[model samples]
Target: MHIKKAIERVPGGLMLIPLLLGACVHTFAPDAGKYFGSFTNGLMTGTVPILAVWFFCMGATINLKATGVVLKKSGTLVLTKILVAWVVAMIATRLLPPGGIQTGLFTGLSVLALVTAMDMTNGGLYAALMQQYGTQEEAGAFVLTSIESGPLVSMLILGATGVAVFEPRLFVGAVLPFLIGFALGNLDAELREFFGRCVHPLIPFFGFALGCSIDLGVIAKSGFTGVFVGLAVIVITGVPLILADKVIGGGNGTAGLAASSTAGAAVANPQIIGNMIPELKPMADSATAITATACLLTAILVPILTAMWARKYEMLRNKEQSAQAAPAQNPSSLAQDGHF
Candidate 1:
């Protein structure tokens, strides 16, 4: 059974396939992890730890000499994504109800859901896609996008005031493992090679763990409204990301598309932020469901879109290159054919 080969045939399949499998386990046997106990349970609940190690491995793969490029690419994507979400938040305040829509087909839609889904790029998904379709620098771009892992960015974008504030330590904590690996990797080439090898191997582990957190039922419960929010997220965030990648990040816009996905972690942000703001608490459950659906939807779609865009970009680039080389390679033939 060409299982590995089969998975590779599907875009983002290394990640998405495991994620789906895990979601199935969660949906059908929610207590399977507990029932099995020990390591099995750990794998079921090890998303954060697995991702932490993966981040370290990913950082190890980066050479410090190329840090500047990575920083620029990551920074461009991160800032553009956040800025877009902030602008949406400002508009949503006027357009959406304070308590979210409570009637009709769009009853559960809310600004919290919109912003949460819009603000954070699924770093793991972006990195996995970029590693397959982009440059090493582009793959390293997830280094900074990790900042969007929690509810802080959403809270800030949504104008959470008073006690809600950025915690410097949380930001530090987010990148510390990567930083440590980066330092060690730079200091010793052997360490870099050893740790870097672990990056790709770890993808499915965290993917499964990430999937375990999601209940596939949520998407169905949220229905078409959830699907609409998911598509809205891709379009609304994706266009700007693509343009930013071309104009600023110096790529063919594939990285931006990869970064436009909603993080699986973003599903929890609604409730976390809502707990702080009482008015939003009522909508948190709805927001969580929509965000989860968006997470799953984007996870499946962004990789496919990025893959398509990358292939098209590569074809266009090759065509241009061939066009430029034609005059140099076939000047005599051209002159004879054209009588120039």
Candidate 2:
């Protein structure tokens, strides 16, 4: 059936397809995962281990000698995304109740969901868009953005904003895998290549595991609200990113637009946070569902917006070049006419 090709046809489909399949199983045939015994159950439920390995492999793929330009570009986007989310969370805190605001349209719109959806950009989507519309260094920028895939940044924003408190060890444990892999990768090229090759194939594995935790019913309930949150994330985070990319990254705003989407890995953050804070458990399910919807919406929208911006930028640059060359060409024509 050429499943890979089919999935590739959809935006973020490689991860999204397996994730939806997992969600279906969890929704319609929840017992199948449990009945299949340890391996299947573990495959469905063991997202942490799968994500740990994915993070390690992801880190290994990053080049240690990445230029300062790439780091700056990536860092600008990352910091902008986190800052936007943090600001949104702080504002939400002031506006909403401690339990969170629940209107008729949206059931579980909280600081957790807002920050989780806004903080992380879809690295795969950004890489793909940049590859098509940007330079090599811009595409390589995903190396830094990938670091935002886990919960550490969200936890930090939450903690820093005084919304949540976490232990020192929790922060360390969250980043340990990526740090270990980054260190090994920098120390040895061969080891980096060896682990780097394993990254792509592991995506669907963890994607499905993440989906297993989501209930489609929650997604249905959050329908319109989820869409609103997704668009909100794009506009809220995208504007600052565009400015940052232009000023710091020295590019047209495509990189910033590219960074607007939510990370698929973000779907796991609510559950992870809930595990640490028991009081948050009730909100986790709804948050995951909402984040998943946001991921889908952003994945579909960011590529289109990036492509349009790139095309417009190219057209403008061409016009400027033609305008500059016209005067030079006219002077040569005038000289030829004088000789005639």
Candidate 3:
């Protein structure tokens, strides 16, 4: 068992290590998230290289023929992801602690804006979701469409609500993932495959970095108070999505991608959080870090837990589906159905 191979299998799982390491540096010797943070020039450089490689692997995963359908569905899902997020944000705000989260709505707006500002069309997570649901074909086109469209539609509606922030730089970050995938697509297969292999290893390194940042201290500040807050946000962010998926999806569909909420929608997220609670920043940085860690954990944990719950839902739904279809199978059954 190559330890390296095992690491890639659990991509986000390992982020705890890095985040912990970062925190340790901050704690022990102190002054850490600074030096290495300098190279974190996600701005000019963009995560294009990493994004490109992930896209390439994603490309390799798909049925080349289905690419067209994937693109169409992706555009639609982007809109859906946005709307779901924004709607969740609006609804969640009323329940928030008020003063709008610190005498302003920063926490409410900034990051959650990015949270709601998504689209599933680009990120590798969508690819992962597609994998979980059997295949692009099995999940059907429209269901996947909603997941991708979620973020786009969220932004549109919220923008209409008169909530705005100034972050032109983030706009670039916002689109970078999709652009990374697109740029890589223009490449030939051999090159793409090579890049994918090369970058895949480094991918989990982020996870390790993410983990190191964690301190039992962050957890303590948050304590049950923070836990409840984070959990509230998670529940706020995910429940409606579950209903929508159950109603429209094929058993285990969008539930698979719930992790996206946890992954850090940093780009447009800050804006959304700000709109609802402007003063969220001072506390937000800490909250967001803790939340990001918690959210990512839930992204995986929720789906797995929900998948179990979904089995029951699916059984109930399937039982009904079967009962309904049974009548069509035979005239005697139709008569029997009416008797019940």
Candidate 4:
């Protein structure tokens, strides 16, 4: 049936497909998850355990021996993304109330949602876009971008912005599995490959479990606002990323534009963070739905935007090169015509 290929056809399908299925099960047969008792119910409801393992596997896939070029390319994008989110969050804290701004179209645009949407770039989408419109190093940059996949970065941004407070131990606990996996993987080559191979298959399992926590009704309420947040993410993060790519990464802005999308895993962050900080519990559901919508919207748009920008840059470069070569091509003719 070519199910994997078919899923690949959809934007962010690897995670999104399972998420939608879980949402359906949650919405239609809410009790089904509990009917099969411990195994089925536990697997369906136990998002934290599944995600913990996925994070471990994800960390194992990272190669610390990445070349300087890959590190620089990735480092610039990662730093710029996190910095932009931090700045936006700080601004929101100053301007908005503690609970967040509530307008008719968008009820709650809090630091939590903003940072959640802004902090992480979708590594898969960025790699795909860069492979088509950017340099090889840009695609390889996903190695570091994947490090931003979990709740750690969002928690950091929130804490830095004074939006939420987290304990030191909670921070350690959040990233402990990843750290362990990274250590073991780097220590043993065979362990790295074995665990790395397990990463992709675990994505759907955790994705579905994450989805079980979301309600489609909540998604409907936040859908339009989520679209707004998606566009805002691209522009808010895209501009600085473009400049950073040019200045620090020494490449065109395609890589920057490519890094502006929200990661699919980010849909789970609001809930995870909310559980940690009881104050954020009230906004978690809305934030998750909005973040999921934003992820989908950006996943569809970032690639198209990067391709268009690349084509424009290529055309301008070609025109300049042609202008430079014109004088060399017909120097004798230019002298005769006196145009040069």
Candidate 5:
């Protein structure tokens, strides 16, 4: 069957499809995990362990030997993405209620949801888009942007902006696995490839585990609000990234637009962060639903926008090249035709 191809056709399918299936199990049979009480239960309730391994394998995939252009492009996008999310979180602290909006068209929306969705660039989506519409270096920029995959960046933004507090040790724990994997991978090329192969295969497993914590009703309640947050993520992160890409990274804005997405892995962050800070626990489920919606929305939109922008940029570039060559090819004809 073409089941794998079918899923690949959906935005964020490997992650989202499994996530929805897990959500179904949670919604319909909340006791299934305990009832099974074995490896099945472990798969049902293994978000943290699965994620830890995923992070480690993800780290192994980064070679640290990327060319200067790739690093510069990625660095610009990553920093810009985080900075924009931080700024939004800071502003949101004052504008939105601490617990989030309690009523109205924006019901169930929270600062945690906004920041989580905004902070992480969907590296898989961006890499795929860039592969089609950008330079090879731009496609490779996902190597660095992958750093935004876990909850660490969200924790940093929330902590720095006073939206939440986290102990110093929590910060260390968050990145230790990834850092160790990175060191080992750099030390031995074979180990890097071995661990790297595990990265994609692990997505659905963790996605399912993460979804087991969510209720579909929450997703239904927050559907519209989630779509809004997804749009905000793209616009809020997209503009600065584009400017930074052009001015500093020496490229058109396509890469920046491509990077303005919510990572499918980001769907787990609010839940993870909420567990770290008990005060934030109440909103985690709703935040996950909202962030999941945002992940799907941006995965679809960013590519279309990036492709349009790339084609336009290419056409203009070609037109300019033709214009520049006109004088060299036929100056006499131009003068005779009253063009000079």
Candidate 6:
């Protein structure tokens, strides 16, 4: 118990431990990555057989009202994600030369794209902003929520490119489930209700997959470039989000902090990039190897930054609120005293 608590105090103890364990298994045993690869591979290969539930769940989780509001208000952020990612891709292509980053940059972009594309986890913050600012229903708050949920796009684009994502394989996995769901959804309301109930519960199985593979020691071996990239992505990817927010009128540190935050394995990008540009597999692999390291590092930083940003925003907000109210209250109170 004491040892576990002590470990927890170390930064990224949870991630660090699992990464280490995975590496230890991979290194000492040597065949571990292969075995782990096999599992992920098998999952990818067999995924098409069972993906319907996931898609259904994904569809259901997207609340219709929120999604519609998000679409109307957040069209720009969504467009921004695609455009910025494309620009980054194009620049990477130009600078890489000859081989021109067929792999490394492609690999890194896939990883960065995940962070760039997502904002779902910010729902609570969006709700809080809406409540405090009296603009929940306003276009601004909806746009904010839309921005926060950008990762969905990142995952989709990256996955489509073959980031060990179940995308193409997903069709394979989802076929049966889709057929079943399609048939059931059409024929009987009860079955539709059943699928509605059943689909989302399986989403957390993805969490199990996350928990199972995350061994700590792999991070220890990641080295300096890995750490540098984490910081770099935080700065590089985060700057755009901040810039976008400022231009659109939602530029708070909270959104950027959250925007740069990441989760799951980012190494998947290499495989995705390699698939997109097969000529650069070596670079892609190098990038993939490094990015997983960076992701774990950044994931640790996210919550700390978010908490810090929120506190700062709150302090500023409170100060502003007090400043605005004081003049109005003071005069009225003075008039009341005079009357008395």
User: Against the true structure, whose TM-score is highest?
Assistant: 5
Error of 3 at 336 (Å): 21
TM-scores, each model vs. reference: 0.69, 0.93, 0.58, 0.94, 0.96, 0.55
Worst 10 residues of 2 by lDDT: 96-105
lDDT tens digits, residue span 200-283, model 2: 898889889878887788778887877989999999999999999999889899999999999888888888888877776777
Error of 6 at 18 (Å): 5.7
TM-score of 3: 0.58
Better of 2 and 5 by lDDT: 5
Q: How many clashes (backbone N, Cα, C below 3 Å) per candidate?
A: 0, 0, 75, 0, 0, 31
Q: Write the number of the candidate with greater lDDT, choosing between 3 and 4.
A: 4
Tens digit of lDDT per residue, candidate 3, span 271-313? 2344334554344334444454444454455556545654675
Worst 10 residues of 6 by lDDT: 117-126
Cα-based lDDT at residue 207, candidate 6: 28
- Whole-model Cα lDDT of every candidate shown, in order: 0.80, 0.87, 0.43, 0.88, 0.92, 0.44
Q: For candidate 6, report its TM-score.
A: 0.55
lDDT of 4 by residue, 9-75 (tens): 8887888889888888898888888788788998789889988988998888788999999999999
lDDT tens readout by residue for model 5, 52-96: 999999888888898998998999999999999999999998999
What is the alpha-carbon lDDT of model 5 when measured against the actual structure?
A: 0.92
Task: Please say which candidate is ahead in TM-score: 4 or 6.
Answer: 4
Which residue runs of candidate 3 sit more than 4 Å off their true CA positions? 1-11, 32-78, 91-164, 167-170, 173-181, 207-216, 223-226, 229-234, 237-239, 246-261, 264-284, 313-340
Model 1: what TM-score? 0.69
Tell me each candidate's RMSD, in Å, in order: 5.5, 2.3, 7.5, 2.0, 1.9, 7.7
